[model samples]
Target: MTTARTLAVPAPAPDAAVKYFGAELGFEVDPDDLVRDLEAGRTDGYAVVETRAPEAFARARIPGAINLPYRDLTPESTAHLDKTLVYVCYCESTQCNAATKGALKLAELGFQVKRLSGGITAWIAAGYPTEGDKAPGIRCAC
Candidate 1:
């Protein structure tokens, strides 16, 4: 019998992380890029979808983003949507997986999908505008 040998592997660099689009998960849109597209109306048949709950969406959402909570997505519900448009799904923040779930659902329904990197929180942090009645309004702490 031949002796078995083991090989040691070194860890990746501290900075080695998926900064932009992740290859394994396909394309991902950075917050700035998405904002540019939205501002310039250069979507090119792309749809930015908010995958969070209605309440979250109603409170605030990226300008022009349509609300389509992940839990309510289905063939029937999505029938009216253009299948050719690339669907970019986003949720609360990087910590939220709702966007990923929405992307997968859209992809299954034959729509090209890209997850929005960093989600809505990142968008707000980037100083992009949001649309909705419940969006942050004038506040006073007198």
Candidate 2:
């Protein structure tokens, strides 16, 4: 019996985060590639920011992820932050606008941030981790 849950085409050299620099005040990241690296513990100097609320972070999250809800971002947020060049912002899903909003806000603050192309939903759909899916989203009371 043939299983329909396999990639028809074998991926070569693993997926790489595709940088879309020409976008309006932002860029997109290939979540598939990001998840691969994270799972393999091959992630480099990039910073993965979960735009989830603190309560959500307390519940669960991707290991090594920094919790910074979209509402907390400001010109001062990047201060004393790591020297990481790439900042990936992700929320609940592609249907959620928090990541994009946060990414744009970070860009305005002069941070090189990118939205996790399609967000965590895409990552989970790609068979990635859902360690934090149990944590519901926070819509920023601010």
Candidate 3:
């Protein structure tokens, strides 16, 4: 009589979920990296896309970032954008999912995209500068 063989699957390591997810589909950028990229002029091939409303954008946003609210994304609206350039999407804060939604839409449209991990709140908390009528120049010394 022949015995049937069974395959055994190993269990995931403890506290490896976050890392596994990050590694499987990495698309998050921290505030420091964003700032560093901007300072190095390496952001020429990227676009910091604010995925919030116009009012929110007008109130305050990343320097040189363009407004493209998640709710308003459309084929026509994004038609003029450069597909070759990577798009960095951010919303209000870590609690907000607008940036994720926007990134998904952009990805579906065949555009490379990444989501700002903690969004604008983290950026401001990191002492980064915001641009708007109320906010002037760079808030950071560097």
| Number of the top lDDT candidate | 3
Q: Pairs clashing in candidate 2?
A: none
Which lDDT tens digits does candidate 1 get at residues 1-142?
6444542455455555463324644678789887877778897878889988887887888888898888888999999999878988899887788888888888888989998888877887888898877556311100
The global Cα lDDT (0 to 1) of model 1 is 0.79
**lDDT head-to-head 1 vs 3, winner:** 3
- Winner by TM-score: 3
Please give, for residues 1-142, the per-residue lDDT of candidate 2 as tens digits: 7646676655444233233234533467687667778878887767888886777665555567787788888767768676456778887676678777777777777777877866655665676655544655433321
Worst 10 residues of 1 by lDDT: 133-142
Ranking by TM-score: 3, 1, 2
Candidate 2: segments with Cα more than 4 A from true spot: 1-26, 132-142
Q: What are the lDDT scores of the predictions, listed in order?
A: 0.79, 0.68, 0.82
List the pairs of residues colliding in candidate 1: none
Q: What is the lDDT for 17 in model 1?
A: 47
How well does candidate 2 match the true structure in TM-score terms?
A: 0.67
After superposition, candidate 1 runs with Cα above 4 Å error = 1-26, 134-142
